[model samples]
Target: MASFHLVSLGCAKNLVDSELMLGSLLAADHRLVDTPAQADILIINTCGFIQPAVEEAIEEILALVAVKNEFPEKKIAVVGCLVQRYRDDLVAELPEVDLFVGTEGTAGFADLLAKMIRGENPGRLVLPERSLMDSTLPRVLTTPPFRAWLKITEGCDNHCSYCMIPSIRGPLRSRPVNDLLQEAVRLAAGGVKELSLIAQDSSAYGRDLAGADLPTLLQALLAETDIPWLRLLYLYPSGITPLLLELIAGNRRIVPYLDIPMQHVSDPVLAAMNRHYRRRELESLIAVSRQVLPDVALRTTFLVGFPGEDEEQFLAIEDFMRQHRLDHVGVFAYANEEGCAAQGLAGQVPAEEAIRRRDHLLNVQAELAAARQRQYLGRTLEVLVEGVSAETDLLLEGRSRYQAPDVDGCVYINDGTANPGDLVQVRITDSQVYDLVGEIVPDVGLAKEKNTARG
Candidate 1:
């Protein structure tokens, strides 16, 4: 039984993959160590969506290589999107890596590594299969026991001109409804209170499946799992159906939180990027969401400086953001990556200008988020305890139903004795730019508590 360590990078979807790999190794009786230096094997799950992500992954690999050098017997493997996207290129550049596994190749990693360790020649490059993970697959929860990510689908079919997901991840593959529900049941049984449903485009789930769709899957999950909070992420604007909206509006367990990645709001830019929805459609969708779920927390992402995105177009997106005052927004400058259709497109926004736009959007959202936070003041909210606050040990930190893990803000409990994974009621007392300050109600029962927060 070899000791192994993992460095998982990128989005929650990739994190799920890392957890699966970890679970597989653990089931095989391999021990997990805290650091690479103490492990006989080190694995890096990488992201290659953009140039910056690629560079970040490469830097981490190099750092791990240094660690491997210190321990000559330690083996290193690099896997995931980076390997899928740049297999040949990475192999040529990173000859020191013992194995390279892509999205599809991840399933067989444990056996492949075992062969390599046994002095058998397992080929360095693994070709990924076009498939989706089901409930039968093993996974070790990486998130806190109270919260877990449930990736329901794999790959992309949108084929946006500016994106390369379809090429790297292959076509859309939805997991069987029974499979997802079984996994959720297992998670809930293990004390998971919040389950964030994720996919390349969550709203697109079950499109390729027979007689199945997102709403149906959601209803099944709600009926089967006793989890307290079910959040949805990575929902494309165009895929937001009326039935889905109705389901979200009516279901209390399904938190009123939406994460839609609206790349841009300008018609011309949208066309250039091959986004299916128009400006009007996006506006209508937002309006409908607001009308249906008044208290819904809308989280979105905007890609600035796409090819041919002029100042006027950029201003349009800014105007839309100002008008909507979204609960959470992520703004990113475009990176022209090879293999993406946008790479050779004309009128590429300059790097400096893109950075300027990204910064401007971020500043705008900061103020908007601060204003949104002010609403929670004095309101009682259900907060799932995560752990001790990073800012100070005197306070415990967790998130409200409106706040998704990691990407969204957190609520710092000024006075509470609740343990991690426990859901407690907290009354908002103060607000920050991106976080909330709260205290457990005086009468609220905790596993351990001595006095009221005001005392």
Candidate 2:
């Protein structure tokens, strides 16, 4: 049994692919190692969504190739979107990489790895069908036992001019509801308390499928799994129907959190990026969400300095942010990846100006996030314990429905005796720009009962 080390990069969706690869390797009796130096085979899952990501992936791969030189027997494999995007180029440029597997070729990972180790050619490129894998596929959970990401769909349909996802991952392909339910059941059975639903565009799920949609899928998942938290990420604004909002409002397990990637609020920018929704539509969507679910924590991402983005367009986004007071906001300066439609677009914004715009938006959001957190002060909210705080062992860190793992802030529990998966009520004591300080509410039932008695 050969030992191997795998490095997974990119979004949660890509991480799912990496986990599946790990599961395949384990099934093939390959041993997983902690470091590249200790492994006989090394795998690097690359991301090529944008220029910065591509650079990072290349740098990491070069570092691993250097490690391979020290131990000549170590086999190297480069897989995922980066390889899919630049297969021939990478093969010729990086001869040290024994195998170059694309996004669709991950299913045959075990066989490919085995063939390469035995001095057999595993083919320079393997591009299979552009579809999602089934629940029956082997998948080792790489996340904490308490939380797991459920990819309900694969690829994307929306050809956002700036995004390379459609070209890299292919068109939208929604997994069957039955298959997803079985996986969710397994995850819940395996003690996963939080199930985060992910996809390139989750709101676009079921568009290609017959008699299906995201709300219906959520209903099935809620009915079947006992997972405490079911959160949705990467939901495009276009497909967020009223039924979806109603479903979220009705279910307690379905967290009152939405990650809508409203790239820009200006009409001209939206039209330029082919976002499909205008500024008025966006405002209406936010207004309806606030009306339907008052406590809903709205999270959104913005793409600043896109081609043709001007000072007026930039200020419009700031104005929209001020008007909405969104709970969480992420800003990224656009990068013109080759092959994307935006690459050839006129009026390309300079890299330095993009950086300035991104910084300005972030500064504004910092103040907004701090103010939004203050609203929760003196109130009790349910938080899922993550683990010991990175700042100090004395303090434990966890996330409320408002906070997504890694991207959003955390709730620091000052004094709490609870396991990682335990869902406990916490009383907010202090607030920061992003995080909140809270203490686990002792005798939660009793506190509620006392309040009832007082009422």
Candidate 3:
């Protein structure tokens, strides 16, 4: 059996694809290694969603090529979005790469690897066809023991002007509800307490499936098993339906958190970016969420600079942030990717201006996040213990329901002993812009009992 090492870079969706590819490799009797130096084959699952990401992917491929040069017996293969988007160009530029597999043609990864192992040059296998939904193979999760990213769908149909997702990933395709449930069940059975539902647009889930929608899938998932937490990510503001809101409010399993990537608050910019929601509609959605779930932790990503975005539009976003006081916020300076419609549009903001705008937005978000976290001080919250700090073994790190895995902040447990993956009650003592220091409450059962008696 051949030994291989795979490096996955990009979003959670790309990580899921890499995990599936790992499972395929394992099933084909290939031994997995941690580093390229220890493997006969090195696979890189890359991202090409944006310009910066494309550059990073290319650099990573080159780094692997250096390793291949040192070890001529080891072969290197590139797959995923980067390969999907620039297959021909990459093959021409990076001749050191042994194989280049596209997103659609990834199902045959095992065969490709087998051919390369036997000294056959597979060249570039960039399949133009888009795979059907529910066709995704099973994945071998690469996350922590307690948490797993459950991808409900693949690809995206939303051809946002600045987004290259549609070009590389193809159209939106929802996995079967039954398949998702089975995966969820398996995860739960394997002692996974937290499942982060991920996709290009999670809110647009199941529109392609017959009689399936976000609410319907959530209901089905809730019915199947009682996972400790079901967190949603990449929810489009335009697709936040009333039924979905109801599910978020009523379902105890669903955490009161949403990651809606509203790229811009300005209506003009939104329109230019092909975003369907307007400023008024966004306000209404936030209002409805706050009305229904009073403690809902709203997280959003905003693009600071885009084509046609002016000073006034930037101020509008700042005003929105001040008014809304989001629990978590991510800011990105827009990068013009090749083939994106936004690239052809006029009024491109200067790079320096874009960086300044992005910094300003981040500064605003930092203040807002700090202020919001301060509110949690002195209040008891449930945190899932993830790990202990290396600097100080006494400091345990975990996250509340409000905090998503990587993008959001974390809860630091300063006192009390808890193993990784244990859900414990903690009292917030101090707050930072993106993290909280808390004392883990010992005797959680006693506290619950006391509260129950008082009630």
C-alpha TM-score for every candidate: 0.96, 0.97, 0.95
lDDT of 3: 0.86
lDDT of 1 by residue, 69-127 (tens): 88878889998999999999989998889999888866667887788888797788887
All-Cα superposition RMSD per candidate: 4.2, 2.7, 2.6
User: In model 3, what is the error at residue 95, expressed in angstroms?
Assistant: 0.8
lDDT of 2 by residue, 162-228 (tens): 9888989988899999999999999999999899999988988888889889998998997887777
Which regions of candidate 2 are displaced past 4 Å? 443-455
Q: Pairing residues by index, what is the TM-score of model 2?
A: 0.97
Ranking by TM-score: 2, 1, 3
| Segments in model 1 whose C-alpha atoms lie over 4 Å from true places | 442-455
Candidate 3 lDDT tens digits, 215-330: 88888888896687889999999898887777777766688898899999999999999999899998999999888888899999899789889999999999999999988888
Candidate 2: residue 70 Cα off by (Å): 1.0
Per-residue error at 144 for model 2, in Å?
A: 0.5
